[model samples]
Target: MRRILYAIAGTLSLITGLIGVVLPVLPTTPFLLLSAWCFARSNKRLHAWLINHKYFGPAINDWEKHKGIKASNKKRAYVLIVLSFSISIYVVPLTWVKVLLLFMCIALLWNMKRIKTL
Candidate 1:
């Protein structure tokens, strides 16, 4: 039952992470990491496949090995966060929504800054 739950959670996280690739408001790495975690506990093969994935694998492995992200990836993430959030902020009509989005962006940026760069 525990393994089944983990597998379900892992699959959901993977799907969310994939969606995050297209939707900037959603985050990719954290969900991917969560999926990996769930998979590691539930299914070794799924974990191994995720660890070997072309685009996300390196980031996951780097985080696992060094507890940090690559400098280049970090920089790219920063750019994406700023650009996407900026666009969203500009497009949104509600003042409160804009303020909320701004705060969220700041929080995300701060969190990224706290992470060690590899």
Candidate 2:
């Protein structure tokens, strides 16, 4: 059951990583890392596959080696961040929801700032 659970978690993490490609606040690297870890625990083949993936491999390697996000990635993330927050703030009707999204926007910015910009 432990292996099954790990596989499930790995799948979910990978899905989140995919979503993070379009969602600014949801970081791709962290989810990819979690997926890698879960795959390592559950499936050797999957782990190796992730380690060698074309688009994701570089980010994972950079993270492991230098512990930083790429500047190009950061620029993209900032643009997504702004658009996501702006759209949410515009469409959401509830004041509380707007405020929550505002906080989330700030937190995302803070997180990016805390990371080393490669």
Candidate 3:
């Protein structure tokens, strides 16, 4: 039951992370990290595959080894977050939603700032 739950969580996190590639509101790295952790607990093969993935592998490996993200990746993430949030805030009609997005943007920026840069 525990393993099954972990597998399910891993699959869901992996999907979300993939979607995050196109959706700036959804973070990619954290979800990928979650998937890696859940897969490591549930399925070795899946974990290994994720760790070896061309695009996602390096980030995971860096986090695992150094507990930090590269400065280049961090800069890219900051740019995307700012650009997307700016567009979304401008295009959104609902003031409340815009405010919520603003908060979310700040929180994400804060969290990213808290993470060590390699």
Q: List all candidate RMSDs to the true structure.
A: 0.9, 2.4, 1.4
* Pairs in clash, predicted candidate 2: none
Quantify all predictions' global Cα lDDT against the true fold: 0.96, 0.88, 0.95
What tens digits encode model 1's per-residue C-alpha lDDT throughout 1-118?
9999999999999999999999878889999999999999999999999999999899999988899999999999999999999999999999999999999999999999999999
Per-residue lDDT tens digits for candidate 2, residues 64-87, read 678888999889878878898999
How high is each candidate's TM-score? Answer: 0.95, 0.81, 0.91
lDDT of 3 by residue, 38-102 (tens): 99999999999999999999999999889999999999989998899999999999999999999
After TM-score superposition, the amount by which residue 109's alpha carbon in candidate 1 deviates from its true location, in angstroms, is 0.4
lDDT of 1: 0.96
Clashing pairs in 3: none
Clashing pairs for model 1 are none
lDDT of 3 at 5: 100
Better of 1 and 2 by lDDT: 1
Name the candidate, 1 or 3, with the larger lDDT value.
Answer: 1
After superposition, the stretches of candidate 1 with alpha carbons farther than 4 Å from their true spots are: none
Better of 2 and 3 by lDDT: 3
